[model samples]
Target: MLAGLQNVTFEFGARTIVEDATWHIHPNERIGLIGYNGTGKSTLLKLFAGEYAPSAGTVERSRSTSIGYLHQDLLSFDTNESILQVALHAFDKAKKIERELEEITKKLEEHTTDELLHAYSEKLHEYEEAGGYTIEHRTEEVLQGLGFSNSDLKRPYREFSGGWRMRVLLAKMILQQPDLLLLDEPTNHLDLPSIEWLEKYLQHYKGAVIIVSHDKYFLNRMVKKIVELYQRELHIYNGNYDFYEVEKQQRVELQQRAFENQQDYIRQQERFVERFKAKASKAAQAQSIQKRLDKLDRIEDVTIERPNIKINFNVDKTPGRVLVELKHVSKHFKNIDILEDASAEIDRGDKIALIGANGKGKSTLLRILAGAEPFEGERKWGHNVDDAFYAQHQLEALNINNTILDEMKEAGSKKTELELRTLLGCFLFSGDDADKKIKVLSGGEKARVALAKTMISKANFLLLDEPTNHLDIHSNELLIDALNRYQGSLILVSHDRYFISKTANKIWEIVDKKIKVFKGTYEEWVEWKERAESRNQTLASGSAPVKEVIKETPKASSNGQPTTSTGGANAPINKEAQKELQKQQKMFQQLEKQLADLNKQKAELEAELSNPSTYADPEAFKKTENAYRQVKDKLASVNADYEKVFEKIMTLEEQQS
Candidate 1:
C-alpha cells in the first residue's frame, strides 16, 4: 500500500466529513474519489495526504512512500526562470552532481591531481546513473505533451496564466514519478487534446493515482475503482464509474428492503409491549421484550440526495431553417492562422459541439459566431433569430453588492421568485442560500450565479462556452438534462466528452483553417473517425474525398456507397491490427487517386495528339508524343504499386480473421 486511512474519523468543526472510514490504496490503483458538491471529497484527500489529522483512529503510510500532489493551490508557485528550468528541478540529485562536476572540471583545467580526477570520475558516474543527460529532453517532452510549445518552454514561467502554470506543475510532477499521484480536478485546466494526452500517459504510469473530478467520461475511462464519500462514510466500489452506478443502485435497493423488513419487526414488538404492559401475568414478559427491543440494532432508512432543477428554456420565436450562415470567414492572431475562407451553416435545431485542441480557435470561433469578435467574414443571421452568448464576461459583470436573488430577478427571465429559487437549488444555492450577497460567495458560487443568469435568458439560439466548468457531477447532469430539453438551437464548447455526447446532435471540428461538419452525434463522430483512420483517410482531407462517407446516423449501421476508401468498417477488428490495415489501405487509396490523375493526363495527351494544330508544328507533335509515353510509364508503375497494396490488404484481413 502507498498510503491509506485506517478507521479514521475526520471532522471540520461541527460537520463530520468521514466517520471511522477505512480504505486501502494498493499499488497501481486507479481510483476516482467522487461525491456531490460540499460533501467533503477534498477534505478526504487532505486526510489521506496527511495535511489533516483524523479526529480518531489513524492515517497509514509506508515509510518510504513518496507522494506527488497536484491541486489548484500549486498556482501560487512563482518563478522567473524558463519553464524548462523549472521542470528540470525534478532531477534534484542529478542537478547537484552536475554542479559539482562543473566545479571539478574548472579546477582540473587549472591544475590536475589524482584525488580530483577520482572525485570527478565518481561524480560523473553518479550524474549518469541519475539520468542527468536526458533530463532536459524528458522535461521538454512532458511539457510539450501537456500542450506547451517549443518556444513557450524558453519563456519565463511567471509570464504564463494560471491555467498554463498548472500545466507546467503537472508536467513537473509527472517527471518526478512519485509512488502515488493525487490529482484534484486535473482535467479542469486541460483542453481536449491535453486531457487525451494525459489519459494516454497515465494509462502506462507505474505509480498509483487518485483523481477527484466531476468529469464522468474521464472517470469511466481512467478509473478502475470508485471511493464515494456520503453521509460521513466511505463506500468502495471495485469497478469503473459505470459499474459503480449499477452496483450502487443494486446496493440501495437491497438496503431499502432490509430497512423495510426491520421496520416490520419493530412494529410487531411495540404492539406486543403496548397490549400486555397492563396485564399482571404478562407485565414482566413485556418489560423483558421491551428491553430487548431497545437494545436491538436498527437500520436507518436510505435517502439519496441528488440535485434536481427544472431548466425550462422558453424560445420566444422559432427561427428559419438556416439559423446562421458564415461565408469566406478569415481569422488570425499575428502569424497564426485560425480560419481562412471557412464557411459553415448553423441550421435551426442543430445542436453543435465545436471541439478541438487548445489554440485551435474554439473560444475564438464562439466569439466570431456571437459577433463579439471582429473577423474578415460575413455572418448572416436567419429570420426571427434571437441569440445570446454566455462566456466569462457574464461573471465579470456580476454585481458583488447585490444578493443572488436580486441578480436572478434582474436577469429579466420574467419568472417568479419561486421559479428562480428552484433553479438556484440546482446550482447548489438552496433555501436561504439565495439571500446571500454575491460578495460573500466563493468564486465557484459566483460562477454558478452567472450560469443561472445565462440560463434564464430568452434567446432562441444560445452559444455557451465551457458551461460545465465549475459544475459538480450532479449539477453537470442537471445541466445536461436541461440542455437536452431546451427547444432552442445551441452551440456549446465543452471539454466534458459526456456532456457533448449527451447534448450535441451534430459535431463541428475546425481542421486546417476550415470547418468540417459531421451530421451525427459525438459517439457517431468518434465511430466515423475511427473507421476513417482505419482506412487511412483523414476526416479533414486536403482535397475531395473518394466519396462522402457520412450518413444521417452512424449508430444504426448505415453504409454510404460502400466503395473502397469511403465505407465504414462494420466488422470489429483489433485496434492495433486495424492500424496496420489502415496504412496499407491508405497507400492503395493514394495509388488509386494517382491512377485517376494519370488516366486524366493520358486522356488529355490523346486529345492533344488528335488536334490538327499539333501536326502543324513538328516540334510540338514530338513533345506531345514524349509526354504521352511518360504518362503511360508512370501509370504502369502506380498500377503495380496499387496491385501490391491491394494484395497486402487482403492478406492482412485474412490474417486478422
Candidate 2:
C-alpha cells in the first residue's frame, strides 16, 4: 500500500469528526469520499495531503513519495504570472535539478579531474530520473487535458476568472504526477466537455486518487472504491458509489441485527441480576453473570440515512404549441460573434437539453432564448408561455442584503409567511435561517434560496442554466423529480448526466458551430454515442469490429392495451413486464410515504431525546432512543427497496411507452 491509516482519530473541541477510521489506499486505486456536508470529507482530504495530522494513530505513507492536493479553496498565485508559468511550477524541483546538472557540466568542461567527472555523471543520471528531457511536454499535455487551449496558455493569471485559475491549479497538480492525488470537488466549475476530458485523463492516471464529489454518476464512472463518513465513523466499501450503496444497506442490516442481539443479551443479564439480588444463595451466580455481561463486546447501533429531498412542483398548466421560436438569431461581443444564425423551435412541453463544449455559447443562447439578452434575428414567443429563467449566474445576480423572504416576495409570490417559511424549510432553511442575510450565506445556501424563489414563480415555461450547481445529491434528485413532473416546457444546460437522463426528452448537442438535435432520451443518446465512437475507432484502425446496441422496447399497459411511444415500432413493451413494473412503482411510492412518515417520527423522537426534561424522565429518553433506532432501521430497508423498485420501473416503462 502506498498510504494507510489505522485507528485514525480527529476531533474539534468535544465533537469527534473522525473516530477509529481505518482504510488503505494502494497505487492505482481510485477512491471517492462521500458524506453529508460538514462530515469531514474535506478534512480527511487535508489529512491525506499532509496539511493536517490525526489526533491519534498514524498516517503511513511510503518514504520519498509525493502527494498533490487540490483543495476547494484554490491556491492564490502572483497576478503577473502567466497561466503557463503557473502550471510549470509543478516541475520546479526538476528544473532545479536540471540547472544543477548544467552547472556541473560547465565545471566538468573546465576541470578534467576524475572526481569532477564522476560528480557530473551522477548529476546527469539524477536529471534523467527527474524527467529532465520531457518536463515541458508533460506540463503541456496536462494543461491541454484540463481544457486550456494554446491561446489560453500565455494569459496572465490575473486576467483569468477564479474558475479558470482553479483549472490552472488543477493542471499543475496533474502535471506533478505525485504518488497520490487528492482532489476536493474538482468538477465544480467544469463544463460537461471539460469534465469528460478530465474523467478520461484520470482513468489512465497511474497514481492513487481520492476524490470528493456529490456527483454520483461521476463517482460511479471514475472510482473503484468508496469511503463514506457517517456519525464520526468511516465506512469503507470496495466499489463505486452505486455498489457501495447496496453493500452499505446490507452492512447496516447486519449491524442492526447484531446490536439487537447484544441488547437482548444485556437485558437477560440484567433480569438475572435483579432476580438473584434478593437471595444470598444466588449472589455468586448473579455476580458471575454480571462479569460476563461486562466482558461482552458492545455492538454500536447502526442507523442508516437515506438521500431524501422533499420536492413538489407548482408549475402552471402547459402552454400552447410553439412556445419559443428563434429565426436566424445572431449574437456578438466586441464584433466577435459568439452565436450566429442560431435557429431552433421549441414546442410547449418539450424537455430540451442544451449541450456543448466550454466557451461554445450554450449559456449565451439560453439567455437569448429567455429574453435576458438581445439578438439580431426574430425571436417569437407563444401566447400563454409565461417564462421564468434560472440563470447559471443567479447567485451573483442576487442582492446580498435581501433575505430569502424578500427574494420570494420580489418574485411576486403571494404565499403566506408561514407557508413561505415551510417552503424554505424544505430547502434546509428554517426559523432564523430563512431571515439570514444572503451575504452571510454560503454559495449552496444561496443557490437553494434562489431555487425556492423560482419554485414560487410557477411559470409555464422554464429555462434553467446549470440549476444543479452547489446542490447536494438529495437536492439534485429532488430537482430532477420536480422537473420530471413539471407541466412547463424545460430547456436546461447541465453537466449532470443523471439529471438530464431523468428529465430530458430531447438533446441538442452544440458542436462545430451549430446545434444538432438528437430525437431521443438521454439513454438513447448514450447508445448512439457509443456506436459513433466504435465506428470511428474501426475506421482509424482499418478494421471492423462487432457492434451491439441494446434497443429499448415499449411495453403494454396494466389493462393489456398497447401504449404508443415516440421511438416507433422499435420501442415495444412486453405487457407482463409492464404490469410487474407498475406493481413495483406503486410499492415504491407506498414505501416512500411510509419512510417519510417514519423519518418525521424519528425526528420527533430525537428532539425528545435531546430535551433536558426528557432526560430527567429516563424512561422517556430511553423509549425515544429505541423508537429512533427502529425508525432508522426501517427507513434504510425501505430506501433499498425503493431504489430496487425504481430501477425496475424505469426498465419496464422504457419497454412499454
Candidate 3:
C-alpha cells in the first residue's frame, strides 16, 4: 500500500467534517471520491497530500514514496515561460542529480583519497537509480499525450486559458509519475474525444490514482473503488461508481429495517413498564427494566435528505398547436454568420439537446430560441406559449439587496410562504439561508437560486443552458430526472454526456457551421459514429488487393470485371463486421430502455387497480387490465429479443477475435 488513512477524524469549528474515516490507496488502484458539496472531499484530499494537519489520528505513508496532486483551480505561473518549459520542471530534480553525477565523475578522474572515491561511487548509484538519462523523453511523451500539440508546446503559458493551464499542470503531474496521484474534477473542461483518450491513458497508467469528479460516466469507466463522504462520516466501497450506488442503496435499506426493529423493541418495553409500574410487588422489576432500557445501545434513525430542486412541471392547459417554429432563421453577430438558414421546430413535449464544441454558438442559438436576443430570422411562436429561460449567467439579473425568498416571491408564482420555503429548501437552502442577501451567495448558489425562480414561472417551454454546471453528480441526476418527467418542451445546451444520454430524446449537433438533427439516444449516436468511421477507413484503404485478385481470376466478364465470387473474396470488407456490431449494440440499448419504461407503466397500472374507485367503472377496469397484460407480454418479448441479439453479438465478437 502506498498510503492509508486509519480512524481519521477532522473537524471545522464545531462541525465534524469527517469522523473515523478509514481507507486505503494501493498501487494500480483507481479510486473515485464523491460526496455532496461542502462534504470535505477537497479537505480530505488536502489531508492525504499532507497539506493539512489532521486534528486526530495519523495518515500513514510509505517511506520515501512520492505523490502528485492536481488542484481544481490553476494558480498563477511564470508568464515568460512557455508551456514546454513549465512541463520540463517536473524533471528538474533528475537533472540536478545528473549534474551532481557529472561533478562526481570529474572528482573521480583526479587522484583522490579512498573516502572521495567512495562518495563518487555513491553519487553514481543514486543517479542511475533516478533514471536521469530518459527523463526528458518521458516528459515530452506525457505532454504530447495530454493534447499538447507540437505548436502549442512553444506558446507562452500566459496566453492559454485557465482550462488549458490546468492541462499543462496535469501533464507535469503525469511526467512526475509519483506513486500516488490526486486529481479533483479532472474532466471538467475536457471534450468527449479528449475524455476518451484520457481514459485509455489512465487504463495503462502505473501507480495509484484518486479522482474526484461529478461525471458519473467517467467515474464508472475509470474507478475501481469509491469513497463517499456524507453526514460527517466517510463510507468506502470496493468497486466502481455503479457498484457503490447499489451497495449504498442496500445499506440504506438495511438501516431502515434495523431502525424499525428497534422501534418495535422500544414500544414493547414501554408497554411492560406501564402495565407493571403500579404493582408494589412488581415495582422492582419495572425499575430494573427501565434501567436496562437506558443502558441499551440505541439505533439512530436514518434520515434521507430531499433532492435538490425537484421540479414537477406539467402543461395543464395546452398552448396553440404550433408551439415554436423557425423559418429560415439566419443569426449573425459582428458580421459573422454563426447560424444561417437554420430552422427547427419545438413542439409540445420535445426534449431536445443541442451539442457542439466550444465556440460553436450553442448558447447563441439557445438565446435566440428563448427570445432573449433578436436575430435576422422569421421566428414564430404558438399562441399562449409560456417560455422560461435558465442560463448559466442568468444569476446576474437578480437584485443584490433581495433575499432568496424575496426573489421567489417577486417571481409572481402566487405560492405561500411555506411553499416558497420548501422550494428553497429543495435547492439546499434552509432556515436563515433563505433570508440571506443574494449578494452574499456564491456563484453556484446564485445560479441555483435563479433556477428555482425560473421554475416558479410554471412555463410550458423550458430553455436550459448548461443547467448541470456547479452541481454535484447526485444533484445533476435530480435535475435530469426532473427534466425527463417534465411534460413540456425542453431545449438544453450541455457538454455533460451522461445528462444528454439520459434526458435527450433528440439531438441537434452543430457541425461545420451548420446544425444537423438526429433522432435517437446518445448511445445510438455513438454506434452511428463508429460505423461511419469504419466505413471511411475501409474506403481509404483502396482496392489494391481486389485488383490483384481480378488479374488472377480464371473467369472474367466482357468488361474485364472479375467474377462476383472472386471480388467478394478480395474486398477489404471489415466495415460490414463493424456495422453488425453497431446494430447489436443499438438493439440491446433500445431493449433496455423499453423494458424500464414498461416496468414503470406496469407499476402505475397495478397501483390504479388497487384503488377501489377504479372498479366502479367496469369498462375502464377491463381496459386497464388488458393494457397491463399487453405491457407484460411486450416486456417478455423484449427480453427474449434482447437475449437473442446479445448472444449473436457476443458470438460475432468471438469470431472476429
Candidate 4:
C-alpha cells in the first residue's frame, strides 16, 4: 500500500466529517472517491495528502512512496516564471543531478584522477536514469497535452487565468510521476479533448491514482475501485462507477435483509425473556436468554437516506413549430471572432446539444438565444416562446444576504410558501436548511438552488449551460431523467457525454467558427465523425470516390404523362444502382447477424467462466477460459468490421436518397 488511514476520524468544530474510517491505497490501483457535497470527499483527499491530521488514529504513508496532489484550487507559483519553468519544478531532483554531473565532468577534465572519474561516471548514470536531458521535451509534451499552446508555455504564470493555472499544476503533477497521485476534480475545468487526453494519461499511469470527480463517464473509464464516503463512513466497491452502482445496491439490500432478520430474532427473544422472567420457576432460563440477547452482535441499518430534489420544468405553454432560429449570427470578443455566420434552427420539441472546445462560443450562442447577450445578426424566437436559461455562473446571481426560501420566492413569486418550501426540500434544503443564508451554502448547494429557480420559471424553452457542473452522479442522473421527460424544448451546452447522449436528439457542433447541425444522438454523431474522418483520410491518400450510376428511364412530361425513355431525362436511380443497393443492404444484414451471433456466443462463454462449477474443475475452467478469450477477440474484430460495413451502407443509402 502506498498510503492508508487507520481508524481515522476528522471533525470540523462539532460536526464530524469522517468517523473511524479505514482505507488502503494500493499500488497501481485506480480509485474513485465519491460522495455528495459536504460528505468529506475533499477532506478524505486532504487526509491522504498529509494536508490534514486526523483527530484520532493515524494516517500512514510508506517511506518510499511520494505523493503528488492536484487540489481543486490552483497552487501558488512564482509570478515571474513561465509555465514551462513552473512545470519543470517537478524534475527538481533530476535537475540537481544534472548540476552535480556538470561539476563532476569539469573536475574530471582538470584532474583525470581515478576517484574523480568514478564519481563522474556514477553521476552521469544517475542523470541519464533521471531523464535529465529530455526533461524539456517531456514537459512540453505534457503542457501541450493539457491544452497549452506554445505561446502559453512562454507566458508568465501570472498572465494565465485561474483555469489555465490549474492545468499547469495538473501538468506538473503528472510530470512528477509520484508513487501516488491525488486528484480532486481534475476534469472540472477541462474541455472534451483535454479530458480525453487526461483519461489516456491516467490509463497508462504506473502509480496509484485516487480521483474525486463528479463526471460519471470519467469515473467509469478511469477507476477500478470506488471509495464512497456516506453516513460518515467509508464504503469500498471493487469496481468502476457503473459496477459500484450495481454492487452498492446489492450490498445495501443484503444489509437491510440481515438487519431486519436480526431485529425479528431479537424481538422474539425479548418477548420470551420478558414472560419467563416474570415466573420464578423459569428465572434461570430467562437469565440465559437475556445473556444470549446481550451477547448478540446487533446490526445497525446502513441504509443512507439521500435528500430528494424534485426538479420539474414547468412549461407554461407549448411553443410554435420553430422555437428558435439563428440566422447568420456572428459573435466576437475583443476583436476576435468566436463565431462567424453561425446558423441553426430549433423546433419546439427539439433537444439540441451545443458542443465545442472551450471558448468556442457555445455558451455565447445560448446567451444570445436567451436574450442575455447581443449578437451581430438575427436571433429570433418563434411565437409564444418563453425561454428560461441556466448558466454555469447563475449561482453567482443568487442573493447571498437572503435565505434560500427568500431567493426562491423572489424568482417564483407565484409559488406559495408551502409549495416553495416543498420545492426547496427537493433540492436538499429542508426544515431550517431552507432558511439558511445563501452565502453559507456550498457551491453544489448554490447550484441546486439556482436549478430550483430555473425549474419554477414555467418557460416553454430551456437554455442550459453546463447545468451539471457541480452535480454529483446521482444528481446528474436525476437531472438527465428530468430533462428527458421535459416537454419544453431544450438547448444545452455541456461537455457531459453521458448526459448529452441520454437527453439530446440533435447535436449542434460549433467548429471552425460555424455551427454544424447533425440530426442524431451524441453517440451517433461521434460515430459519424469517425467515419467522416476515415473517409477524409482515404480521400487524402488519393482513393477514388464511389461512383454513382444513372440510367435512362421514362419520366413525366409537362402534361404529367410518361414520356418515352429515348427522349426523356434519366431517373434518379437505375436498375443497376438498385441491384447494388440491395446487395449492400444484404451485406449489412449479414454482418449484423454475424455480430449478434458472436456476441451471444461470447456471453455464453462469459457465463460459463463465471459459474462456480466451471471453476471447481481447474482443467475445464482453463479450457473454457481460453475459449472465452478467443471468442472475445473474435467478437471485437467482428464488431469493428460491423461498424465499417454499417458506415458504408449508410453512405450508400445517403447517396441513393
lDDT of each: 0.83, 0.75, 0.76, 0.79
Cα RMSD to the true fold for all candidates = 15.0, 22.1, 21.4, 14.0
| lDDT accuracy of residue 469 in candidate 1 | 86
Q: Predictions ranked by TM-score, top down? A: 1, 4, 2, 3
Model 3: which residue pairs collide? none
Give the TM-scores of the predictions, in the order they appear: 0.81, 0.74, 0.72, 0.79
Better of 3 and 4 by lDDT: 4
Task: Give a tens-digit lDDT track for model 3, residues 50-88.
Answer: 998778888989887788889964566547799888988
The lDDT of model 3 is: 0.76
The RMSD (Cα, Å) of candidate 2 is 22.1
Model 4's number of clashes is: 1
Ranking by lDDT: 1, 4, 3, 2
lDDT tens digits by residue: candidate 4, 1-657: 889999999999999998998998889999999988668898888888888899998999998999998986555554789999999999999999888966875664455565765665566567667876468878988998888877689989988877788998999999999999999989887888788899999999999999999888899999999999888889999999999999988988999999999999999989999888989999899999999998999999975566555566667787789988888988889956888887778887899998877767788888888888877999887999988889857678999999998998898548888889877765667678998999998877888888878878888788888888777776777788788888898899887888888999888877657776777788877876675566534432223333321212123323221111122333355456556656655676677788788878877875664454553444574588688778767866876777676666555543442
Q: List where candidate 4 sits over 4 angstroms from the true fold.
A: 75-78, 99-121, 307-309, 394-396, 416-419, 425-431, 439-445, 537-657
Best by lDDT: 1
- Clashing residue pairs in candidate 1 (N, C-alpha, C atoms within 3 angstroms): none
Predicted structure with the largest TM-score when compared to the true one: 1
Alpha-carbon runs more than 4 Å astray in model 3: 76-78, 94-151, 277-288, 307-309, 314-345, 371-385, 542-657
